[model samples]
Target: MLKSLQNIFRIAELRQRILFTLMMLAVYRVGCHVPTPGVNGQVLASFFEGTQGTLLGMVSAFTGGALQRMTVFALGIMPYISASIILQLLTVVFEPVQRLSKEGEQGRKVITRWTRYGTVLLSVVQGAGIAVGLQSMNVAGDPVVPNQGIGFVILTVFTLTAGTAFIMWIGEQITERGIGNGISLIIFAGIIANMPSAIVNTIRLLRTGAMPPVTMIFILVLMVLVIMAIVFMERAQRRVPIHYAKRVVGMRNLGGQSSHLPLKINMSGVIPPIFASSIIMFPATVANFVHVEWVQKLAGMMTPSHWLYNVFFVAFIVFFCYFYTAVTFNPVDVAENVKNQGGYIPGVRPGKATSDYLDVVLSRLTFAGAIYVSVVCVLPTMLIGQLNVPFYFGGTSLLIVVGVGMDTASQIESHLISRSYEGFMRGASIKGRRG
Candidate 1:
């Protein structure tokens, strides 16, 4: 491992990319501490202290506590993620988006441009909502927003929108010139930034006898096991054997090759949990700003500790697992492409039969994957309820952390191999969940 770490710097390009990515991440972390104008960050933080297991707490986790601190980066990359998801969903129902999606690189550029526009629109709306929400928030008589007016709202909207736009740009730059998926890495960084504090708090609890040593050991063991399960499930794949028949070309004989199409056990990656979390949290978040009796009751039921919340979260995870997988992977298209390339699965006929077979296999895989993801995501809530620990120790955050870590390692391994150096694991190569 030490040699592999040294080997990374041996290649100049890889070294530069790693350094550049670190610099960009540093910028993001610095921005997270720069408070937004006209807000009392200390008071806001105090208010957030009581909001654990609520929607605001969830958003704060993804923002690296920026939202709690009322920092410039409070908006984070959620607006961009929401925009991308919206555009992706539109491709399934909207003909124009579908047509553009099929247009290759130029089409992707157009879609990307539109996604940026959508991100800005979402940022404006969300920032305005947050500003308005802050006006109403107070701890014992101290308002989170000192001077509340239309002017403050407008300024906040602009500041947050700009902050999100800058983050999007940084992510794009990292993707183009650095390593790994830039947006995922940004999120990984955010989720991991609070780890030290969480650890300190845990130790404090242990030292103060607030938490039993046995419970601490159990939590550590559970985390290790859960992380192992995630790594295993993410790397697991269903290989579909494809046999290419011998074919006569114009002048030379070709074809006659065998290869396997590796379909991931979890083709949707972390999208299911993310989508489910956002959908489930939306009502509670809206309720936070609205001071209605019934609305408050509804939000109360939506808390993470509620059984109904877990049920709905699991159901949504399963639904999105299939929905996103179907949208991203088409059995009919795969069959068509395979037929065109003279490839056929053994014992399966070429046309609809092949598509049906693949679909059946994919359906089973999706079911299992959904179950695995649902279990992992819901476990944290159950553990939190049982142990009364911090919400920062969540399954979704760990999943993202592990997934992003694997992806970054895979990219680094690719660079090492391309340069004739050994990878981190020597003969073993890292494979991320996405691929």
Candidate 2:
């Protein structure tokens, strides 16, 4: 492992990419401390402290506590993520988007342009909502927004929108010139930034007798086990064997090769959990702003520990697992491409039969993947509620951290292997091919 770390810096390009990513992430972290104008930072933090079990807590987690601090980056990259999910759904239902998606690089560029526009629109709306919401909130009669008016609202909106836009730009730049999926890395960095504090809090809990030493050990063991499960599941795949028929090309035999398509056990990656969480949190977030008995009741029922919340959360995760899988993978298209390359599944005939076979396999895999995702996400909630852990230790955060770590490490290994250098593992390396 130490050698691999040294090897990464041995390559100039990879080193630069890693350094650039670090620099951009540092910029983001610095921005997280820059508070938005007109907000009482101490009061806002106190309010969020009381909201650790609410949707606001979840949002703050994604933003690295920026929301708790009422920073300019309190909005974080969520608007961009929401915009992306919206555009993806639109591509499925809208003909123009679907057409543009099929148009290759140029078409993708057009769609990207539209997504950027959507991101800006979402930032504006969410920014305005947050600005308005802050004016109404108070921590022990101390207003979160001290001086509230049109000017404050406009300034707040502008600061938040601009912060989100800047974050979106950083993500794009990281993707182009740095490493990994820039958006995912940003979220990863945010979640990880709080780890040291969480660790210290856990230690303090132990010393204060709030949590028994045995319980802390159990939590640590459980975390390790869960992380291991995630690593195994993320790397698991169903390999469909493909055989290329022998062909005569200019009196020379060609095309006699065999390969297998690797369909990931979790084809949708972390999208389902993210999408499900966003859907489940929307109502709770609105409820925080609205002052009504019924709305408060609904919000209470939707708290992280509530049975209704878990039921809906699991359902949404499953629904999105299948939905996102369908959006990303097309059996008919894969079958067509395979046929064009003179390859066929061993037992399945070409054309419709092949497509049908692929679809059935994918459907089964997606169902299993949904079950895995639900278990991973819900188990942490159960643990936290029952054990009263001091900080967010698992669930969606764990999944994203492990998933992105695996992907980034795999990419690094690929670069080393391509350069004829030994990967982290001796004589073995992480595989990149997946269908």
Candidate 3:
């Protein structure tokens, strides 16, 4: 590992990309501390100090406590994520979006433009809602705002929305010039940035007997094991055989070979948990702003500790697992392209039968993937995080960090090998072919 890292800096371009990614992440962290105007961050922090069971609290875990701080980046990259999910859903439910999704490069550009617009729109709406809502916030006996009203709200809305736009731009630049999937890296960075503080808090709790020392050690051990399990599951996949007919191309042979499509064990990645979080959190967020007693009660009912919450979370993850995989990986398209190239799934017929075979295999694979996601998500989330021990299992947080780290490392290793240098695993150099 040390030798491979030494070789990494030897490659000028790879080193620059790594440094650029770090710089952008540093900028994001700095933004997380730059509080939005018209809010008392001390009061905000106090209000959220020990409130870890709520949905907002869970989201705060991922955003690196930026939301509670009311930072310029209070919204984080959630608006962009939501916009992306909206576009994906539209591709399934709307003809225009479906057409654009099929238009190749031009269609992709059009959809990307729309997603950007949606990101801006969502940012503005969230900013405005937060601005209006801040007036109602209080900590202890003090109101969180304790200042002028409408003018402050407008200024805050504009500032936060602009901040989100800036974050979106930063993520785009990172993707274009740096490393990994940019938005995922940003979220992963945030979660990782909080680790030192979390560690210190755990130590303090142990010293002060706030938590038993043994429990802290147990938690530490569990974290290590969970991390390893995550890595193992992330790399697991099922390869489906694809065979092509022998072709004679102008007195020479061209296409007579076999390959396999690798269906990953976690096909949806961290998207399912993120989607589940948003759906579960949004209602609780609105309830926080609403003053009705029953509304407040209903919001409490949506808290992560609730049985319904876990049940719905798992169900939603499974639904999205199949739904997103179907949208992102189309069996019909795969079958059609394969047939066009005189390819078949060995014993299966070329067209419709191939599609059906793929559908069946994918369905079974998706079920396995869904089960894995549910176990990973629920074990840490519902079981461990409920202890109120100041330990942030942040299951999705860990998943994104691990998954994105592996991917970025794989990319860097590819770069090293492309230059004929050794990768970290030496003889076991990892690779990812196009899906």
- lDDT accuracy of residue 228 in candidate 3: 94
Q: How far in Å is the alpha carbon of 358 misplaced in model 2? A: 0.4
Predictions in order: lDDT: 0.88, 0.87, 0.82
Q: Which pairs clash in model 2?
A: none
Tens-digit lDDT track of model 3 for 52-116:
75777777777887887889888888888888889999999999999999999999999999989
**Candidate 2 vs candidate 3: which has greater TM-score?**
2
Per-residue CA lDDT of model 2 for 105-216, tens digit only, reads: 9999998888888888888888888888899998779998889999998998899999999999999999999988899899999999889998998889888888999998
Which of candidates 2 and 3 reaches a greater lDDT?
2
Q: In candidate 1, what are the lDDT values of residues 150-187, reduced to their tens digit?
A: 99999999999999999999999999999988888888
lDDT of 3: 0.82
Best by TM-score: 2
* Residue 357 miss distance in model 2 (angstroms): 0.2
Order the numbered candidates by TM-score, best leading.
2, 1, 3
Clash counts for the predictions, in order: 0, 0, 0
Q: Residue 145 deviation, candidate 1, in Å?
A: 1.5
Show the colliding residue pairs in model 1. none
For TM-score, candidate 1 versus 3, the one ahead is: 1
